[model samples]
Target: MEFNITESIQILTKTPSVISNLLKDLPETWIKTNEGVDTWSPYDVVGHLIHGEKTDWIPRALIILGENEDKAFVPFDRFAQLKNSSSRTLKQLLAEFEELRTENIQKLQALSIDEQTLERKGIHPEFGEVTLKQLLATWVVHDLGHINQITRVMAKNYKIEVGPWTKYLAILRDKK
Candidate 1:
């Protein structure tokens, strides 16, 4: 989906509730882990998710707002340090996620329609010329991808034993 500021804010706000509903009673420990695909347990997923919330979307929003995106922006690999900096509890990460999402929505909503379309440039060492709009779309897609990954990990962790209905049910979890 194209990432208009309004639609993206909706996606960001809705995700936490969706996660909460799906993971009902599944303890924060289970929701956050270090034992799933790519060695990124549930906890790592939260860490990554929060990191994306803080560093990715919000910074882009700032850039779009004509503020300095540089101070908050970091190189890709350096961002991983956030998880290590704290004991990195799941609750803490979740809290950060909520705060970041709210901030992003507020900042984005404050912007004029023209501001949303304004180009804020970033030079990634790998992908050159990253723009504010592209980052916003990436943020939405990134969250969706992780939600998919989280559910998949949960299914495996709990051994839900999916059947044909599993595929159909999965669709209910995501719009696409």
Candidate 2:
């Protein structure tokens, strides 16, 4: 299907609530457990999403709409959540994420993005020039991917316990 700003907005707005419903008030073991080394827990995923809200999406959208065609986006810090959110409780992170997402969604709507605007270009640090559509689409997919990551990480907690069913659960299947 074609990239529709209205359709994208639908998923974008729901991400916070979807995450909150799946994660809030869970035990620390469920919140903090990772799939393996270097993987993110549900808590860490929320922080990473928060970091994106502050620095990635709208910031890059502005760059795309800005007059400076040469202005490349700042590279995102993929692991900033480890230290940035370590001291905060999962509850705090969840609440903050909700607020940030709501604000960003409002900002996105305020842009009044049209087909012409979606075609606007911005420089990406690694990928060179990219369109607003690609960025917005990525924003939607990024949320979905992370949500999948959160679920997979949660599912991995039961990998061994699932026993016979593990063979049918792709998320828990050994990738190696």
Candidate 3:
């Protein structure tokens, strides 16, 4: 499919509501449960998304647009959410994420991104040079990836209970 910025923003805008619809009011046990060691819970996933909204996406875009290609993006702290979210409740995190995402999308629209700007390059700490289009596309996919991750982690809570039906469940079988 062609990358439509409007469509991408629409998808991005819906993520918080989608997550809230799926997870809100669930028992703490479900929210906190992980498939196993080294995995994140649904709450943790929300926190991570919050961290990305605050640190990763727009900041990197600004770096690219500011013509700072010589300056590589700071390596994202994948686990920063653990420390940052310790005090916040799930509701608080969700609200914060929604608000930040709204603000970031507004900022993105204000940039007046076009074909030329989308082709602008930025230096990634590890990936070397990358286009603005690639970076923006990654932002969308990152959200989808975590959404899938959260769903799989939540579903695995019923992995053994599903018993014979496990054969039909790809989420339980996939070891990410």
> Which residue window of length 10 is worst by lDDT in model 1?
167-176
**Model 1 TM-score on a 0 to 1 scale:** 0.71
Cα lDDT tens digits, model 2, 17-106, are 999999998999999998768878999999999999999999999988988746689999989999999999989999999999999999
In candidate 3 the C-alpha lDDT for residue 164 amounts to 96
Candidate of highest lDDT: 2
- Candidate 2 Cα misplacement greater than 4 A, ranges: 174-176
Error of 1 at 31 (Å): 2.5
C-alpha positional error of residue 74 in candidate 2 after TM-score superposition, expressed in Å: 1.2
lDDT of 3: 0.91
- What are the lDDT scores of the predictions, listed in order? 0.63, 0.92, 0.91
lDDT per residue for candidate 3 within 35-89, as digits (tens), equals 7888899999999999999889999899889954365787899999999998988
Question: For all candidates, what are the clash counts?
Answer: 7, 0, 0
lDDT of 2 at 143: 99
Q: What is the lDDT, from 0 to 100, of the residue 79 in candidate 3?
A: 100
